[model samples]
Target: MASTHILSAYDEELKYLNRRISEMGGLAEQMCGDAVRALVNSDTALAQKIISDDVILDHAEREIQDKAIVTIAKRQPMAADLREIIGTLRIAADLERVGDLGKNTAKRVIAVQGTGVPRKLARGLEHLSELALVQLKDVLDVFASRSAEKAEIIRARDEEIDAMYTSLFRELLTYMMEDPRNITSCTHLLFCAKNIERIGDHATNIAETIYYIKTGAQLEGERPKDDTANTVGAPAE
Candidate 1:
C-alpha cells in the first residue's frame, strides 16, 4: 500500500495526466479530420496545417512522459497505479504513431491534388474517419474514468472499421479496374482508408492498454461479441 501522501499528492497528478492525454487525443482526432477535409475539399492549406500539428503531438507525448516519470519517483505507485504509469508510456507511443499516420495521409492528399483526380473516394474516407474518431473518443472516455465497459465498446468499434476498410478497398479496386482515369483517385482513397484503419487500430490498442491499467492483464486474444456495438471486423488488436 502506498502512503497517504503519495496517493493524495498524485490524485492531482493523475488528473493532469488524463487531461494532457485528452488534449493529445484531441490533436489526433483533429489531424484525422483535417486530413479528410484536405482531401475532400482539395485544400492544400488544410493539408499543410495537418502536417504542422505533428509538433503538438510530439510535445504532448514528451510532457506526459516527463510527468509520469516524476510521479512514479515521488509517489511510488504500486500495483494498478504502477501499471497505469507504464501503460501510459506505451499508449503515448501508439498515439504518436497515429499522429504520424495522419501526417502521412495529409501528405498523400497533397500529392494527389490537381493531378486531375476525381476525389470521389473522399466519401468513403469520411465514413472511415468518423468511425475512427468515435472509437478514439470512446477510448478517451474510458481512460479518464477507467471504465472497462467503455473500453470494451471501443474494442468493438475497431472491428466495424476493419469491415468498412475491406469493403471500401474492394469498391476502390473495382473502380480502378473499371476506369484507368480513376486509378489516381482510387489509389489515394485506398491510402486514406488504410490510414483510418490504422487509426481505428490505435484506438483499440488504447482501450486494451487502459484495460491492463485497470485489471493488470492484457486483453488481446479474447474478443467478445457486442450485439449493441457494430463490431464486424477483428476488433482492432
Candidate 2:
C-alpha cells in the first residue's frame, strides 16, 4: 500500500543520509588530524589543506539537510519515520558544526604556523585527538543502528574528554604564567585542546538529539546546552 512504498523510499533516504553522514565524519576526522599535525609540526601545508578541505564537509552537510527537508515535505511519515528524518537532520547539523570546529582549529594552527610546540604539550595533544575521534566515531555508529544505549556511551567518553581538557588547560596555563615566552605556543595548543573538546561536545549533542527524537526525553540539562553547540560547534558549558 501507500505506507509500504513510503517506507521503502524512507529507507532509501536514510541509507543515503547515512552514507553522507559517514563521509562527513571521515572528512571531519581527517580535518581534526590534519589540524593537530599542523600544530605539532607547524606545517602550514597541512593547515592549508584542512582549511581547503572544509568545503567537502560543508557540501555534505548541506546535501544531507536538503534531503531531509525533501523527505519531510514529500512524505507523510509515521511517528517512527518522522523521528528518523528529524534525527538525521539534527545529526547532520552536528556534523557540520564538527566541520566548523575542525576548520577553526586549523585556522589557529595557521596562526602559530612557524612556532615550535613543547614536548609536554605535544604529548597531551596525542591523547586528546584519540579521545575526540573515538567519541565522534561512536556517534556515527549510534546513527546507523539507532542504539540509545550506545548514544549514552558517547556521553561517558565526553566526560573523559572534559577531564583531559581541564588537565591540559591547567597545565598550559601554568606553563604560560611561568614563562611569558611560551604564551604564543601555549595559546595555539590551547586552541587544539579546545577544538578537540568541542568535537567531543558535538558528538554528545548528536547523541542527545537522537535520543530525544527516539524517546522525547531531554536527558537532564542536555537541551539548552545542545542548542548552543549545534549552531557553531563551540565549546559546551
Highest-scoring model, lDDT? 1
- The TM-scores of all predictions, comma-separated, are 0.87, 0.87
Error of 1 at 208 (Å): 0.5
Q: Write the per-residue lDDT of candidate 1 for residues 96-200, one digit (tens) a residue.
A: 888998898888876677664444556777888888888888788788889877787788767788877877787778888998877887788778778888898
202 in model 1: Cα distance from truth in Å? 0.6
Candidate 2, 1-237: lDDT as tens digits:
998997898788878888888888888888887788877788878888888888888888788888888887887677877777787778877887887887887788766666677888888987888888888887887877777777776776677777777788878888889999889878877877888888988988888876777786666654223222223334667
The Cα error of candidate 2 at residue 23, in Å, is 1.2
Clashing pairs in 1: 159-233
Candidates in order: C-alpha RMSD to true structure: 5.2, 5.2
Instruction: Identify the runs in model 1 with alpha carbons over 4 angstroms from their true place.
Output: 1-6, 116-120, 220-237
In angstroms, the error of model 1 at 206 is 0.7
